[model samples]
Target: MIETSEQGDVAVLTMSRGPVNALDLELLTAFPGALSDVAGAAAVVLTGAGRCFSAGVDLKRIVDGGPSYVAEFLPALSTAMLALFDHPRPVVAAVNGHALAGGCVLAAACDVRVMSGGTIGVTELAAGVPFPTVPMEIMRHAAGSAVDRLVLTAEKLPREEAYRIGLVDELTDDLVPAALARANALAAAPAEVYALAKQQLRAPAHERIAARRERDDPGVAELWSASATQERLRGFLSRLAAR
Candidate 1:
């Protein structure tokens, strides 16, 4: 589910799945550990192995597990995202292709993101699912007014649109190379100072995330477990397969 390589002080972590990289339990379980192991690297670049970056969670898992699956699934994934957000060094998403659903959330959680013009952002909220609040917090912090339109509607913002919305930090045809170069630059900075600066940078968002967790997570979790969400998911999956 992951491929790791060290380039000087930078660690490149690639999501390994053919075509569109979909997140399954295997990915959720493996990614956090892989990220933890590479914590020593001054910077980390997250990309994909094939044509696309990641398409988000596996539909098969959701179909089999039902609505409760989201409650269980999101918390675990959130733990991973939290680790990335709190990691000492910079993390960048190298968006080689489409970044949809949880994939978009993952990209947004990173310190910076670089995308090719063809990449996409799909939240799938009309399918009756929502991203973890932590990632929403990141989006709210990073994109400001852009978050209102993006998150509220759960629209799929294409690469250029995303760039205009400030969801992506940079745009390039050679995403991987550009992201790697930025990672190298970050890695070259003093580690202690970088860590402190990043911590300070994320502090406000972290605080808001914490507050949202205490105030709203149970309701959100309940929404995930609701019968309405299950019905919607079932219909959505059927439609997806049909297409």
Candidate 2:
């Protein structure tokens, strides 16, 4: 589900899957534990094992479970997302490819985000999915005024455009090394102070997201499972498959 490489006090997390990392239930279950295990790490760098960061949530799983199942799973998912926001250490997202939907949320939740030259956006509109209210709130808090294109449009912004929109901290051909270097620099700070500072930076957003997650998650999950979104998603994927 996740591969962790420990180098001193830094934990490098790689999501292993296909050409694109797909967030199935296994990945979701494994994610919280991975973050927990790296609690004491000076910094955390998150990346994909293959050509992409993550494709998003596994729709097949949702389809198989039927629409009603989303509600049961959402609370855990919300917690998992919030955990990254409230992470003790700085979490850097090293984006290797298009991050759509949940993938974008994952990146947004990180303390900093760096994208490879090949990266793109997997906007929810393009995915034929509505932005879950809770996730949108998380994005607003975590990404600040940046990354609005990801919310309003379904368009996939290439690395350059992502940089222009401030969705990425840096656009580099060598994302892994850049992300690692940044992590190391952050690690140089006093560990206690760095952790506390990072916490303070995100505390307000975290609290707001936590409250909304508890209050709005059920309805958001139900909206995600709505027939309209499902049909649109199915059509979009089918077209891709046909292509």
Please give each candidate's TM-score.
0.92, 0.89
- Give the candidate number with the greatest lDDT: 1
User: TM-score: which candidate is best?
Assistant: 1
Report residue 214 deviation for candidate 2 (angstroms): 3.9
Residue ranges of candidate 2 with Cα displaced over 4 Å: none
- Where's the lowest-lDDT run of ten residues in candidate 1? 117-126
lDDT of 2 by residue, 1-243 (tens): 689998667799999966677776667777889999988788999988877788787776666666756665565566677777778777899998878778878888887888984555646777666655556776786556764756776666777877777777887788878898888887787878887997787667667766775567666677778888777778777877898
Model 1 spans with C-alpha error above 4 angstroms: none
**How good is model 2 by TM-score?**
0.89
Q: What total of clashing residue pairs does each candidate reach?
A: 0, 1
RMSD of each: 1.8, 2.1
Candidate 1: clashing pairs of residues: none
